[model samples]
Target: MVKLRLKRYGRKGQVTYRIVAMNNLSRRDGKAIEELGFYNPRTNESSLNVANIKRRIEQGAQPTNTVRYILAKANVL
Candidate 1:
């Protein structure tokens, strides 16, 4: 199953996340099928590819709880 999730990156205490489309069984930081957006918790900032996100969701990609919140906050869901 394909899932829309976050992949952690950046330095130890300054971590950021890349929103990604990846296989459900993969590790949290594993390779992804596609990168969909970005998020920074420290600043509550996010940038998304709206078109691709809608496309993937329509094709059966399920977003995780956190991603769902972000999408809703961005008025994309």
Candidate 2:
């Protein structure tokens, strides 16, 4: 199963995330098929590639709960 999920990165206490498409069996920070966007919680900021996201979702990629929240906030889903 492929999924739309967040990949944690950046320094401790100042983490950020990359939105990506990957296999469900992959680890949290494992390889992804493609990057779709970015989210920075500390700054409450996010930038997304809506077209890519829609394409992925249409291809049967389910979004993780947190990713779903991000998409909701971005009005992408």
Candidate 3:
């Protein structure tokens, strides 16, 4: 199974995330099949690759709850 999820990064208190597609059994920060977007909680900012995301979703990539919410906000799902 493949999943769409967040990969944490940045300094300790200031975290940012990359929206990624990876195998379901992999570590959260492990290798990803593709990086589809970015999100910054502090600034509430997001950048998405909508076309790719939609393609992945249609191919059975399941988003985590948080990622799902983010995608919904972007109107991609």
Candidate 4:
């Protein structure tokens, strides 16, 4: 199954994340099928690729709870 989830990155205390389309069984920071957006918690900032995200969602990419929240905040759903 494919899922839309966050891929962790950055330094220890300043981690940022990339929203990606990935396989369900992969690790949190594993390889991604495609990068759809970005999230920076420290600044509450999100950068989204609307067309790609919408296409993936239409193709059955399930977002994690956190990703869902972020998307809602961005009004991308």
Best by lDDT: 1
lDDT of 4 by residue, 1-77 (tens): 99999999999999999999999999999999999999999999999999999999999999999999999998987
> RMSD, model 1, all Cα superposed?
0.4
Which model is ahead, 1 or 4, in terms of lDDT?
1
| lDDT (C-alpha, whole model) for all candidates | 0.98, 0.97, 0.97, 0.95
Q: Rank the candidates by TM-score, best first.
A: 1, 3, 2, 4
In the range 1-77, model 1's lDDT, one tens digit per residue, is 99999999999999999999999999999989999999999999999999999999999999999999999999999
Candidate 3 on 1-76: residue-level lDDT in tens?
Answer: 9999999999999999999999999998999999999999999999999999999999999999999999999898
Q: What is the overall TM-score of model 3 with all chains considered together?
A: 0.98
How well does candidate 4 match the true structure, expressed as C-alpha RMSD?
Answer: 0.5
Worst 10 residues of 4 by lDDT: 68-77
Tell me the lDDT of model 3 at 16.
100
Candidate 2 residue lDDT tens string, 1-77:
99999999999999999999999999999999999999999999999999999999999999999999999999999
| Candidate 2: C-alpha lDDT | 0.97
TM-score of each: 0.99, 0.97, 0.98, 0.97
Instruction: lDDT for model 4, please.
Output: 0.95
| Count of backbone clashes, every candidate in sequence | 0, 0, 0, 0
What's the distance in Å from true for residue 59, model 2?
0.5
TM-score: model 4 vs. ground truth:
0.97
